[model samples]
Target: MITQKAKYALRALTALADADADEPVMISDIAAQQKIPKKFLEQILLDLKHHGIVVSRRGKQGGYLLLKPAHTITFGEILRIVDGPIAPLPCLSITAYRRCDDCDGEQNCQIRHVFAKVADATRKVLFSTTIADAAQPTHSAEVTRLLA
Candidate 1:
């Protein structure tokens, strides 16, 4: 499951991607536009910066911007930053792979097999999606908010 933190991270990144590349956007602006809580967003932004996905400027007009182009920032990267492993079972995870404590056999674990497929499907969507993709008109807040 995607945590609230991951969702907020994606939301903030999408807002930043919508801005002009030459301009740095204020954190307050992103929070207001995304309706994200300021305190929570600060931490989320900090994590993004630490992961090299975002860079921050400290001054009167300083705020944040993507370290790379929006198209280079994948949803998988954002989710991994905020949500940890993509796979429900650690055994199915690529980076964090470890056998579940209760599971004894790798070849006979039905639950693990099911989750492997789930993880693959999830990875397919998230890895393929980029911050630029999230900024598309079809994904605009006016449309998303209405659907919500």
Candidate 2:
């Protein structure tokens, strides 16, 4: 399962995507609109800024905005940035692979075999879906159809 931080990050990004194309959104506005805590949002936005996913502006009209187009920012990218590897098991991780301590060999590990498929399917959906998609009103219906 994705962490709360990851969820918040996605919600925050979706809010940004829904905003005016050239306008930066204030953290307080996002926090209130998305029901995320202001302090936690500050930290999340800072992390996103470091990852180059977002940029912050300064001054009376300053806040935050997506550095790249919303469509270019995938859900998988945000999850990885906020929650680290997307793999269910470390052995299945593409970016941070590590053998399970109790596993003798990956070739014979049934758990790894099953989780590999899970990881692959999860990655496919996450990487294909973007902040632009999530910001749409029909997103939930599309997701339901995909899951069904």
Candidate 3:
């Protein structure tokens, strides 16, 4: 299950991606338009900034903007940024692998094999899909349907 924080990050990111390229957008504006709480969004944006997904400027005219183009930012990157490992099982994880306590030998484990397949398919879709794609009308519909 995707966490509420991850969902909020995606929403904030897509909102930033939808703005004019390289244009700074205020946190208040993003929070107001995206319906994310201001404090929560501030933290999310800060996390994104640390990940180099976004850059921020401070001052009267300062705000936030994407560090890279939306088309260059994959959903997988953002997901990992907020949620960590994408694997359904730690044994199947590439970044944070750990043996399952109940498992015997992973090599012949039926459950691990099955969940590995699930993780692979999910990873492919997420890693290949860009934020620009998520922000598109048709893609947004598909995402909503899938999440629903």
Best model number under lDDT: 2
Better of 1 and 3 by TM-score: 3
lDDT of candidate 3 over 62-138, digit per residue (tens): 89999989889988889999999999998988899999998889988998889988998888888878888888887
Per-prediction TM-score, please?
0.90, 0.96, 0.91
List the lowest-lDDT window of 10 residues for candidate 1: 139-148
- Which 10 residues in a row give candidate 2 its minimum summed lDDT? 139-148
**Model 2 misses residue 90 by how many Å?**
0.8
Flag regions of model 1 displaced more than 4 Å.
Answer: 138-148
What is the C-alpha lDDT profile of model 2 across 2-111, one tens digit per residue?
A: 89999999999999999997998999999999999999999999999999999999999999999999989999999999999999998999999998889899999998
TM-score (C-alpha, index-matched) for candidate 3: 0.91
lDDT of 1 by residue, 1-148 (tens): 7899999999999988888776788988999999999999999999899999999988887889889898898889888889887888888888798888898898999887887888887787778777887797765564345324
Better of 1 and 3 by lDDT: 3
Pairs of colliding residues, candidate 3: none
User: Which ranges in model 2 have alpha carbons more than 4 Å from their true place?
Assistant: 138-140
Task: Evaluate all candidate structures by whole-model CA lDDT and list the values in order.
Answer: 0.85, 0.93, 0.89
